[model samples]
Target: MQTTQIAPSNLGVTHPLDMLTPQEISAARQLLVEAGLVGATTRFPRLLPVEPTRELLAGYVDGDDDYDRSVLVTLLDTATGEAAEAVVSVTRGEVADYRVLPNGEHPYGQPQYLFEEYERAQQIAKADPRWQAAMRRRGITDTTHTYLSPLAPGFFPYEGETGRRMIRSLTFHRNFEGDNAWAHPVEGLICHIDLTAGTVTRVEDDYAETEPVPVPLQTRHYTPEHVGPARTSLKPLEITQPEGPSFKVEGTHVEWENWKLRVGFNAQDGLVLNQVSFRDGDEDRLVLHRASVPEMVVPYGDISNTRFWISYFDAGEYLLGKNANSLKLGCDCLGVIKYFDAFVADDDGRPVKIPNAVCMHEEDYGILWKHTEFGEAPQVRRSRRLVLSYFATIGNYDYGFFWYFYLDGSIQMEAKATGIVYTGATFPGQPNRHAPEIAPGVIAPVHQHIFCARLDVAIDGDANSVQEQNVRGIPMGPDNPHGNAFTWNRTPLTRELEAVRDANPETGRSWFVINPNRKNYVGEPTGYQLIPMPGPRLMAQEGSSAWKRAQFATHHFWATRYDPAERFPAGDYPNQHAGGGIGEWVQANRSLENEDIVLWHSFGPTHIPRTEDWPVMPVDYSGFWFKPHGFLDENPAMDLPDWSSYQGVPGTDVDDAGCCRH
Candidate 1:
């Protein structure tokens, strides 16, 4: 709990877009305490750095000290369920703005749960008489090892709990301290606990009248100690950079190859890229102003009373960066790595540092381009990419968010989903349509992991427009004499309503952000295309609870005129609110022609559990690409070193690693 002492004199080491340092976090908290905003029950649920305005940044040099630095802290009173947002200026050392959050009104939504609330919910559930009676009926007398999972209670108009801050608890029996709790789910029991009152309002006990479903006795342990075995076939493959990595990091700014960007992290979004640009010739053209996956919804497809109301907004409800994993060397990252430390506020409003929170390294991508004449040696150049990534563990699932920059002026965002699946107990070999049996008695309900990425695009500059391009096939006519001719059509998305579209894989659909003021060598607008990995959108029926809460998932693409307040695709407090995010934003139907705009892309997998997903699931990947369609005149990687130059002579001991040498 030792604090890092920071002063205003050291602010030069940070950019306006950098994540708040431990010193800045503590300074903001001190300003709040001085303003009489801190109470005994007041807790810091979320704290994020407020980015400077575009005008301010346009005038900023690399080490300018006049730019503003601020922090936005979300405060919750755990005793009364009250919430408020405060903006503090660390540079000016004062409170700039403060407002109370209306959390007790209709369509109420509570702030995120504190770390202490998880233990509080467990204590309340175990102390309930009805839950205890149900456990005794199941003949589980030893309650010391019982684990009560604190789950979010999606918004429902149930009596006595309509406007109250609540968390629903599900019981799981653990045999011992290190036992896996998810493997032994106690079916047909739900405990509703009110956080403000510190009591269990109601308990649904299916075993009270009928026979109880037995908890699965299988100990699904995945650690090496429990499953005693070692594979010897694999040989050691060491990835050592005898020279250093190709990327340079000065504070939060990164420069690798022709790509330059600023790194940021917060309690909600784990990693953020700002002021991203690719060097073309002597100029650095802007591509994106800011980019991050701000929110995601994981909704289970089940009709059972045990899990009917289950849709978790991972970033909005439980902060993603708050639960981020401190990455390891060989396990999570390889090669010579550059680590960035992240600082977030704890419940007591103190700075907690997550060391090695962001990992940066270079990866060899096989080949860039190659071609050879009939008689000449093959001319080939190796491809490489700069990767920046971070991982977050939420409940039973762990997610890794990665951002990759290639030498060809392309950017890609990938999300890796891996961990134990959420399971429920049932009869052995039971045939359930909604829930598939992943194990003998364990059934994992079908679910979807939908992630929404916020891209504040700056194609050439801020004045950009969007166009949807789809491939069209020509019928047999003069235009297609051989019946093998097809062309593509680009439609202008001039309004917000027209911009909310879905992916059409059959047409090879993609969206382009183009700057009308700037033109490439071909006389077309300089543009960047957004190519989607098309998949099923949200399967929930329209007007359903899950559908209403996660409207962003219903479409694969959304474009809106840029606004700083519209950072989160889902509304700020999506914990228990009625639907109100991108669903409501597009209703404005504002003009998007030649304006500064933001794009929200929703994409992920709709998972149907399989037998191979048992124990611990391997990494499932889903992502999209933002490539330079016409942003550059030609291939920017033509200057890459030729690998054909490194020829192994007959009697000479030549290492293939020499190909990397210029």
Candidate 2:
């Protein structure tokens, strides 16, 4: 390849050395001499007078002494008329071979053979079309190129002594960390500035690789396209409150709000059963007189009216026959309704009884004479009281509820619990290494860890909660309809084609190919569908925007539950089948290592960081709250000492080694 030269005026016009003071010029000259540029015989005209005889004798004796000297070329800012540091490079041409030294000093020991090889590579690179394209894309249009040339000891060069020169390429470009700095390894034979015209010269290369290098890039914005029709519309419900009656059963208080009876079975139970109704205002609605159950176990089996019974004492009649003594006579028969009130009137403007036919069990007397019939039974009970308490409360800001049941037969009671919904974060992964194609000069990487959230619940009671149950959706293997499979080289969908298209747009196109062994979490089917969107385009349409769109749906539901051990172990439910104890909450009280939870939260869907979310985050409280839940005994007497009331006695300290004494 032929070498292009930028004249002296172009070299020093924006060069720094031209603006240096007289003393600085002297120092720079001395530096150049030390750097093997000027010869020892070259006298400083201002410092000493040169003898013509001596100069002539020296020149004749060592005519080629300065043939291999170095030179310093300064670079200056075009806007400022001040001295800037001079950049130096070396170019050596011998016979048919040529070499160019880089602008900066080589930290590695210079190898002559390697330097020659670099020069040859530069020649090839300058003629490479691919390299030119790369440089153009990098926005490097102008090159104020410089090189080192040998200088003679005399005032002027003699005939045919125009010295050998070497071209070294150098330019100012941004560094790896985005800071402006001089780029290194200026061996490439790029075209430089034309001195007189102050314009960059161009070079053409035909012998380059035909294939372009592959570069991966991510879009700053993504627009999602719908793949299928809308699944369902969300419906809103009104909040319902509890009501009816006032009673104290166990440690819970029950009251009537509207037509419904509100009851509290226990403080820990919050409030149970939002609404309870009664047929008559005077009759009691299932009250529990006593209850005592063992810890960690739910009571089962029928408990009707054995030792427990509701009586109509006001009507002077036994509403439910009392059986405080029978073991085999279980309360299982309590479900049988003996009589129902009838609104009827008779003769003389006075109310009279028009009883309905009663039904009763009969034993067969003989096979031939066996018969059954409806007969009238006397009206014994008028009204009765049913016993049970129900109420609920919001705890730790999470929607949770506790239930207590006092049966009509056994002395044991049962408690049931449940919790709201939540999702957990994924495990950390490796860093991304892909680089952008269009902007190779600008570097960015793919980041992992997205779409994650958490909830915390608190339990304030005697028993601890255990994770006895777990429910996961489909395994979401590489073939699953979710986009996660398509992203990681996963194969085609295993589900129905319509469902797949509706759920995952990344794989909606039949032409899209992926690997067959990628895995992901295929959560339960949410009422959503993915859709196809436009691919990235190199140019914007006329009167159109220039943003690329994404290709998938981004919505789903997550939840958790808590219940009795027997009812737990249920399949496909959030935290279902998990055994329960007293006052348990879900997703609360994270481990000690999470002390920074309130300080730093992981980034969400948006990868960009803003200045507002800093230092510590806002409050994130969750779980159930208990009202009138016995934190302590109701009215216990105590002259409690107030620790906060104490004040320090000024100048009253005793010996430092001893305990505090008056």
What tens digits encode model 2's per-residue C-alpha lDDT throughout 1-662? 43423322332211111111223233334453455533422221111001112133224332222221112222211222111223222111111211232211211111011112223334433444644564455444432231111101111112321121111222223223322121111112233222112232333221123322121121111112312454468663221112211233221123322122222111111122322322122533221111111111111111111100111010001000010111122221112112111111111111222221111011111121112345853222111123231111111011111122211111111122221111001112322123111122222111111111111111111111111111224457656667443233323222111111211333332111111122113431111011122222112122211101000111111112212221111111111011111112222323221111110001112111111211111222111111111111221112222323546343332212222222
User: Would you estimate the TM-scores of all the predictions?
Assistant: 0.96, 0.13
- Candidate achieving the largest TM-score: 1
Off by over 4 Å in 2: 1-454, 460-463, 470-662
Q: Distance (Å) between predicted and true CA of 251, model 2?
A: 34
- C-alpha displacement of 183 in model 1, angstroms? 0.9
Candidate 1 accuracy as lDDT: 0.88
How large an RMSD does model 1 have? 4.4
